[model samples]
Target chain A: MQLPSKLIQDAVEEMAKLPGIGKKTALRLVLHLLNSDKEQTTMLSNALVQMRENVKYCKKCHNVSDEEICNICSSNNRDKSTICVVESIKDVLAIENTAHYRGEYHVLGGIISPLEGIGPSDLSIDLLIERVSQHDSEVKEVILALSPTMEGDTTAFYISKKLKSCDIKLSTIARGVPIGGEIEYTDEVTLGRSIMTRTLFS
Target chain B: MQLPSKLIQDAVEEMAKLPGIGKKTALRLVLHLLNSDKEQTTMLSNALVQMRENVKYCKKCHNVSDEEICNICSSNNRDKSTICVVESIKDVLAIENTAHYRGEYHVLGGIISPLEGIGPSDLSIDLLIERVSQHDSEVKEVILALSPTMEGDTTAFYISKKLKSCDIKLSTIARGVPIGGEIEYTDEVTLGRSIMTRTLFS
Candidate 1:
């Protein structure tokens, strides 16, 4: 075990804690940081600090934002009556990047995975219910954009049960063989979308 | 034309500046940082700052160090009289990991890569000559540990010329088939080592 300097080791340890980053990758990254210009390294350091300091979840929609309300929630052009519910902030970003959806968003933080000890109460489901109930006059459609997983299915079912008596229309994104996709190896998104868009089963 | 936030973009730009990291990889790294824990992200940020703050080149041997002299230069057990000159700090780490060398090190910062607009003057050749010519009675040998590249060869030749009149035995690491290496695709290290260790250069 060749012992690098304490600073290098600390940088490596912190990098290794990131998703998919191992010790070797961490060392490479740290070495890269060392070789970079002083200003560039400082910028990287400050950017990391600033990212955490600036970003916060919007009080209303729970989407990531640098202010009290997220851009989507605050935009007057967006459809306030349609709230797209996603599993996390990344999902919200993915949806926004498409530029096809002009609706507000709700991030559940995570899906309801009982096996992983994540129950319905662990997510922001209650807050979402409160938002819907309080803004009953404005909300007309609730789009479940959760991940295409068993946990996603369970959470959607739970939320749908809670909103059964409400006048709002419950829907999900279309599932089918995606564009430029191979039908043989189609993922859960394609499969789920295909099934959801299937002709009336009755 | 995906316009990420300025904070995210800054992180990506900084990551892209690293060796072997492309824009896509930089984006991936930024996303990883975004997903990382706040405390761990802060740790990484501070580590980058600390890495820049702590390490500096040793005044005596030019090896990277936190003090005026590097660990090898300060250590009493190492053979200080035999100075092994290399290209960079990474070379020092590589040689140290081998655990076969017990001599001191001198980092030239880089070799004489004329193709890359680097010449003897670009390296620490003058400083190395000064160190060698110093009135230190303990000096016995100078080992060239440069890579077996054209630039490395040119740099070694330049150094050897400068040290020609010095009362010290000059040698280089061997060139030959490496241990556990096949002759078909033997790298420069093994080939160079084999040649250096050869009885005659037929």
Candidate 2:
């Protein structure tokens, strides 16, 4: 859509570049910013720029952090012996929100997706191996907490193979019907897997 | 949700302040930026800042512009004898996209809404009146193309009362069931209005 001002157009175009936002939504957002206080726009712009320029990644797990190591990895309360490997930083946050897991996380940054031209080398898998292989490493188990997608399974298999020689145990998050999900509505593959991996009743 | 870094949290918070965006969506967008090139985030930030700092509004109509006089107002091809009044700059773009309206526009910036504490004085009603009342004014018709909401009708009525003494003709855009809209499914108010204002077939 043609905007009245070039500046507004540029801002809309930039906002549209983000995932899920289209030109129309971008236009609306830009118009909203135009109508709001200049300070609001300035604050948003400064925050984004600061995030890009100053944001750091955990040296070991590649999770977004303000320091060399992420808070989880650096915390004394977190169990460094059990690392939960996931696809992205968002996954790390999702797991953290549960409050059920106290283990440190290894953010893969992404999973192996040949369709997207993302290979194993493109992720932080090598860092995970190095972290688990350190001579003085305290790691005893590496849990694959990735998604249930084919890409997630492939990444899990690849990591398991790479750590086969290590003394640490390798496992994955359970795949099953969600707690509130209706059994009839569950997909065939998930239902079948859940049945096959049924746990013993206490 | 607890974020891993304060910078990420700040960016997410600012983004969430925008209309229609929530914390989860904001985090997703911020993470997408973080995973992509640093230059991409820099460009988006720069564009927003530039738009906020450099954007200007048309002196005549209050539409967004880079110059004091907007392109539509300055264009000789446009009809100076007719002015389409709208609630916002977006409305102007919407009308311009139709390519049917050849007249100039007068953006009111907002409608009179007491609940929102917006009044006629907060808009560009005075400028519009002054423009049409100029000694050598060429304006002959003023079209109220505002929405059909109660606020829109109230604003239109207010404008009509204000321009009652002027020689210019005041009209509103036709309201009816939209073209291609199914008669059976159309809302009662719209259907009623369409029937009441039905025109004779030529």
Best by DockQ: 2
- Per-candidate Cα lDDT values, in order, are 0.79, 0.93
Give each candidate's interface RMSD in Å. 2.3, 0.8
Model 2 over residues A1-202: C-alpha lDDT tens digits? 7788899889999999999999999998988988899999999989998998899999988999999998888899988899999998878888888899998899998899999999999999999999999999999999999898899989899999999989999989988999999999999999999999999999
Query: Which residue pairs of candidate 2 clash?
Result: none
What's the true lDDT of residue A44 in model 2? 95
Name the 10 consecutive residues with the lowest summed lDDT in model 2 chain A: A89-98
Task: List model 1 lDDT by residue over B31-103, tens digit each.
Answer: 6777667777788889878987787778888876677777778889998788899998778888998989998
Which is the leading candidate under TM-score?
2
* Residue A52 error, candidate 2, Å: 0.8
Model 1 segments beyond 4 Å from truth?
A: A1-4, A115-117, A184-202, B1-6, B20-37, B184-202
Question: Each candidate's DockQ score against the native complex?
Answer: 0.51, 0.86
Give per-residue lDDT, candidate 2, residue B10: 100
Total clashing pairs in model 1: 15
